[model samples]
Target: MPANNLRRIHSLDGLKLVMVLCIVWWHCMPRVVFGYSLPDLGARCCEVFFLVSGFLEGYRHGLNYKFTFEELWLKAKSKLKRIYPEHAFFLVLSILVGVTSGKEWAVLSDSNVISAICNALLIQAWIPSFAMQFNGLSWFLSSLFFCYLLTPLVAYIALKAKRPVGVWHLLVATMACRVLLEAECAKHPDIYSMVNIHENPLVRLLEYSFAYYLALVYRGRLGADTCSKKVSFLWSVVECVAIGFALYCVVEFNGAWPRWMYTLVFSGVVVIVAGERGILSSLLGCKPMRYLSVYQMQIYISHAVFYSLGWALFPTSSVMAHVSLFVLIVIYCFAVNCLKRIRQNKPKPTVTESFYF
Candidate 1:
């Protein structure tokens, strides 16, 4: 599809808000509040974020730009420009807060300095021990950096193929590879023990590849328009079934399903939500949802910073504490966003101001 024909997929922004809110809830809430425990969707939420990211990455490739190295490099650089400044800003603030609080577990210790550097460079996910250091949740950015580096190759392979890499082809191949890796890890327990199982970049890359291939197929088959459409009865039935299965995994299994299972459920939900016109879709596409989506990265990054400080400074044993922290973090995110806009909109230097004295 031509670039102009493609419209921004508003539903995706809504999806991102849902996923990010889940993550925030996971982070801010105590595992067990009073007598009840929170459902375990935190990790699954991360996977959802990865899925959306990979979809957009491939969708952009399909809309414009060649699969050449230069174009890919430019894309990578653009991602860096978008994310690194915010990351660095938060990292510095996190370190400062940790130091000022005199908290023993902050990111500023001598032993943790190396891990902090890894986080700073966005390479922490590659090292198991380093992945969760500093702002632990920030590990997503590190893993995503790895995916970004590999995206060009993945996109090129998909685009060059004679046919869309069938969904089955990608699924079977990914599952086979995962099975082999699992078997090997089983035999050599030390390998798995030495690494963080889920947070590792290699493990997360599976999802990245899955989404990229899926997007390639989607862009080719469905084009760039992902707006809602009336679905036939059978299609609606299938969508409901898929969504039901996904919910079952989350609710009944407490999100203990295998990664592949999670991907299937997320893909189904994403497709249905993005393309099917319904009350839910309308709610997702509303103005408030889309507005928050614009500041998602800021919200995500800022939440980690506040979390670090909150953990250090507050007694978060009660629901009220968690709710208070959540509110403060949201306010902080909005404030930072406003400052960013002010900086962007500041008047540029005049040409005459550059004249030599």
Candidate 2:
């Protein structure tokens, strides 16, 4: 399979929309989606995001495994270009929104000022105390940036592996390490809480690494054979089953399932979704889902800002306010996208010199 085809997987876009919407609802909704309120759907949605991000990064690198310092620098630069501008814009906007609401201390307090610096440098998520401040959702961005920092090394390992199964073995080892760490943390609950373990970028990097290796395996599998109708149908069946299992976990476990199980279930769902040939894929690939997918990041990051506004305006009108805020965010993102397009389309100045002069 060509990289371009992998990139064009419409099912992935639909999946992205699902993840984004789930996160938004989890944050903005008054009540929980599933029967049990223990494990937020939003948390699972983040796992999907992390895995998908790692997979896409690996896919983009294609078969190239060797990385020079220059290549790593380029990769870092590219990721920064994609994320930083919008992130900075929203960071400032969030602060401004707070200040305008007579909450200057939220942005200007000593702790928050320190948090803003950490968030800007993408290190806020690494510290336990600093993890969820500022834009509470922004820790994901910082953690993702950490993954990007390790992309070159991950690519190098994937490229140099003896076989695809080696990548699988690596995933096993990584998970084992994670479990061992959890056990150690369990012994000293006061010192090593879940917040201490889960919130760190270094720990999340282990999860990201698993996803990176999985992408290598997936790409190899994807290229090895063209799925016949029967195989495709079977995979679709698997996809449906995966989704059902996830829902079951949500209800049965009440979000109390082990972390590793959560990772495994969502990773399975992601694989099925990325297969991109199922009936479920066709529905997710629809125009509205795909359109919303284009602004998925915008929706994810900017929703918090408007969330505050929504609650303030409709303190008594929960459902109506939340929905209206969502619509407004979508419109805001659409307008921003349009403006960016127009800016890019504008002609650049040309410089010329007269030979006689």
Candidate 3:
């Protein structure tokens, strides 16, 4: 499908907002919340992010058959430009926090200087130990940047596939590889750390690649401009079932299932949501939900700083304290976004002003 002909998937924005909140909740709340395991929930949420990102990338670039290495460089640069500013801002903030608090676990220590450098370069996830250093959540940015760098290759592969079945084959192959790796890790246990498996760029690239193929499959067979009432109702049923299965795995399985299973379940939800043919998709794609989704990235990056500081200052186990801290973080994210808009809208000097004596 031509890019111009494709409608914007507003439902994705709402889904991203939901996932971001789940991550924040995992970070702030206790392990088990109202009977669900936050860790499992957070893990799947992270994968959802990767899948969503990959889908968007493929949706935009996969059909560009002429994509070249130069264009690939430009794409990588564009992604870096989008993400680096907030990443740097948070990194500096974390350093200042460490220095000001004079805490024993300060990220500014001599032992961590290299880790800080890796974080600065957005290569922290490539190094297992450095992945969680400084702003730990920024490891997502690092792995995502790696995936963005490989976009051209992924898009090229997607374009080469002659049929939807080819895309399915690619998706299954990638999942198989990931499952094999997981099994290897499980057998050795010492060969690869859990952090490595979780934050490794190679592992994440596979997940991202699977999503890319999944996007192609969506474009080929699922995405449609219109649907009959019966079809929409059936889609709604599928969406609900997908959500229920995903949540059940997150809750009942409690991380027992292979990671790829969760990815497949999440992909099902994503494909349906992207269709926007279902009642749930309609609700998700509403104006208010789309608006809230704009600040998801800012919230994800900055929440940890506020969370850590709140704990340090209050040292409380109160549920209300956690709620208050989360509320403060949201407000801070809104303010930051407003300031960014103002800066972007500020006028620049005219060309005539460049003249000098």
Candidate 4:
């Protein structure tokens, strides 16, 4: 199928919104829920975000026959422009919150100054000590920016393969490399800090690259065709099984499995959901879910700030405080989205009007 003719995968948007909420819950209170560790489950959810990002990048690359450095630069710039503004806004907000609340971590020391610099440049994730500086969760954006810059090279290599199996081979090799790194980290826990293993661009990039290759494979095999009734039924079953396997890994395996193993499971979930033929897919892609997804990024980026403020204003252990904080975050995100839309839709002045002004 022609890439230009491909339909939008609305279901992925809904999935993203769901993951954003899970991340918020994890950050607010990292605890076991229904036998699953929220912290570990949150890590898996973050992996899914990386996978979704890479898949979209590869899928967009499929729309073109040629790849060039200029195109790569443009894509990187586009992504940075989209993410950096919000990141900077929240970074400043975090600093203010820290100052007002007299948070020790936000104190201005030499190390902290360096951390601020790194965060400003979106390179905090590359520095283990500085990874959780202002707006700690911004480290995800830092790592994601690194992946965006590499998309051109990754896409070129994947496209050069000329076959889905070849791309799969690349993905397998990357996964093997990730597995070895995970083993090394496991062997020397003292040497590798949590930030080093989790927020390292080099480590996270493997997961992103794996999904990029998987996206190419998906395009080659599925090609955006609408499934017939029988095929849709089969796809629905596959989708359910894929989701079930993912849940099993999160619940049953929990922290026992390697990160790559969970990545593979979540990758299957993404592929199955992207098929858009399943009953679950239809339900997830419903209007309400799609509408809520518009604020997914805003919610993810700003929720930490709200949590910080909530801590200052309310008792940390109070259930009502946590609920109130979550609600306030949602309302703030909604307002932000509304303002963005209004700005985007506002009319531009004509040349004569601008000259008069």
Candidate 5:
């Protein structure tokens, strides 16, 4: 198979930027979504996120999910390179923000430091203290790291009995689990109760597993990329309409819906549509978008720092503050990119033309 199908698609970069936008909105605006709160959406967005991973991994690794432990570890190293530097930067920054704010730095104690040492490894989400208590954006790092860790195994099972059948099974099992869990929670609906479900390792694993598997079955095997521009364009519009309907159904003027999973279902589908290139290729691949998509993760990490500081300095909520956020983050990104480019131009050891690692 041509690697074009397996390689990371340009549109998916756009999809990630969209995910970050959703995250930022959820973080900044809570009342807009009834009384559910911002953190709720932040956590819930994980549902669609992990599913996208399934889709990408399944697509990237091909029909055969089998890989040696070493192979998995090799991939893990590449992931570490991409994620850890930014994580460390923000981890220290978050602590500085908490400490220098003259607030009681409880998470800075000896015991907490010890715990954070382990958490810095980015392995466990089961620990209560580590949950959004320190290094908030580390949530995505830990989640993606965990997803990368399990890709080989997820791929293996997903590739069996033909790809689609396996993926359909995964999807059915996942939705069924969600339905059952929600039905059981219909009575309690307490934050703690929902937290318990969210913390359940099995649930998180299954959710992310389906994400990677979806990418494999649908984007990979379906050859949605091979579709003509016209059909893909039409499908994109339909996906948007479905997304609009889903939003309308869930986001009532009076209050949020009793079950928010409808948004999850709809958003997940809409996101996949966004990832389809021929559908939105021209726009998503445009220069500005390509630029935005490239540095999006950097923007994500840095934006929070600016927003938190801006909030303290301004000490007021206004539309200009939000607008200023976009301007400041763009300036920060450009400056960082320029610095990186200068570094790339620095002197380095010369190598022969035919040299190989």
Candidate 6:
């Protein structure tokens, strides 16, 4: 199949879905499921998100001179339009709930309020929570904005730099990055502990960008439209091994592994997930799964709130409550999609738009 005609793999989608679940379980279940207190794997999931974004952005934003100034701005605008809706909706809703509940946890500080204003502008992710106590998902958005701001620069750099001599150079660079980037992290034994989890923002950008470049390699150029089976296979196996090893560390290593190692592992998994041409996910690529994939942003926005509320109402100790809330979230998604369908079938808002929308 032509790459354009080919749907993304259901396995990749399943990977995403499972990653999302791991995120939820890691956040909500505590030590019960994973034998660790907090998985902090949400960071890993965001890396996957970044890899996808980077690949998609790289593919779309190839050879900067090709697009005129107007086209560039329009492209950026379209990206924002897709990303902003759920974020804005949730932030406002979260604020309403916070204000109404008489709790200061969700209340905005003045500086954070400014950041929130910045966030609302879709310029940055903000510090996440107004009070620094909540808004767990903002971390992903934060890193995403960081990557977005640097996309032009990243493109410029990747386009200009020498391509690696071969896969070995890529491997060496990846390892050197792991060692050097984590050097400061390693020295601070106090900080090296599991609780802190070494979430350096710059490091994340580099990590995801590496995966992005691998995707670029798979596409057969530093920055081009075409795909290459040769380079694709190279990135494919490496990503699989790296991510597989990381999963082992997370599960079998008893959380002894450091955050930097996990980042390395995650970068590997993302390659296979993003570059695998939808082979595995293809088997399960029914409409419902595709629909679920479509609502990723919507579900991401709501999942945190639902989990938090579920915890507040049910707590982790209440297994039945947890199950019930999971069901509720499913129902919530179904209703959201149903309503969206209804609106789509409804008449257009403006006659002008109807004629030329």
TM-scores for all candidates: the values are 0.84, 0.86, 0.88, 0.88, 0.76, 0.70
Q: Flag the better candidate by lDDT, 1 or 4.
A: 4
Candidate 1 lDDT trough over 10 residues, lowest sum: 348-357
Comparing 3 and 4 by lDDT, which wins?
4
Per-residue alpha-carbon lDDT of candidate 5 for residues 239-258, written as tens digits (9 for 90 to 100): 66765665455445223443
Q: How close is candidate 6 to the true structure, as a TM-score?
A: 0.70
Where is model 5 poorest over a 10-residue stretch in terms of lDDT? 348-357
**How many clashes show up in model 5?**
8
Ranking by TM-score: 4, 3, 2, 1, 5, 6
Q: What do the candidate models score in CA lDDT, each in turn?
A: 0.68, 0.71, 0.76, 0.78, 0.58, 0.54
Please write out the lDDT profile of model 6 over residues 76-192, one tens digit for every residue: 676565556656766676566556555465566676577556556653433323313345465566556666656666565666666644533554575577567567566874654
Q: Which segments of model 2 are wrong by more than 4 Å? A: 1-7, 32-38, 63-65, 100-107, 193-198, 223-232, 313-320, 346-357
Q: Give the alpha carbon lDDT tens digit for every residue of 38-97 in model 3.
A: 556668898898888888767655666567777877777877777898899889877776
Model 1: per-residue Cα lDDT over 1-357, one tens digit each: 664465555667777777777787777655687887766767778877777777767665652556677887887887787778777877788778767776454634676888788888998887877777667767888888888888877766655555654554765676567556655765887867654546877777777777777776777777456444654566556656766777778777774555656776787677666554555655666677766666667667777667656665665545555555677677876676566557668443221110100
Relative to the true structure, candidate 2 reaches a TM of: 0.86
Model 2 Cα lDDT, one tens digit per residue, 108-174 = 6788788788878878887777777656777888888888888888777756777767777887987
Candidate 1: RMSD to truth = 6.3
Model 3, residue 97: C-alpha shift (Å):
2.1
Candidate 2 vs candidate 5: the TM-score winner is: 2
lDDT of 1: 0.68
Model 5: residues with Cα > 4 Å off, grouped in runs = 5-8, 29-44, 64-66, 103-107, 162-164, 178-202, 219-221, 224-233, 253-260, 267-285, 312-328, 339-357
In angstroms, give how far residue 148 of model 2 lies from its true place.
Answer: 1.2
Choose the strongest candidate by lDDT. Answer: 4
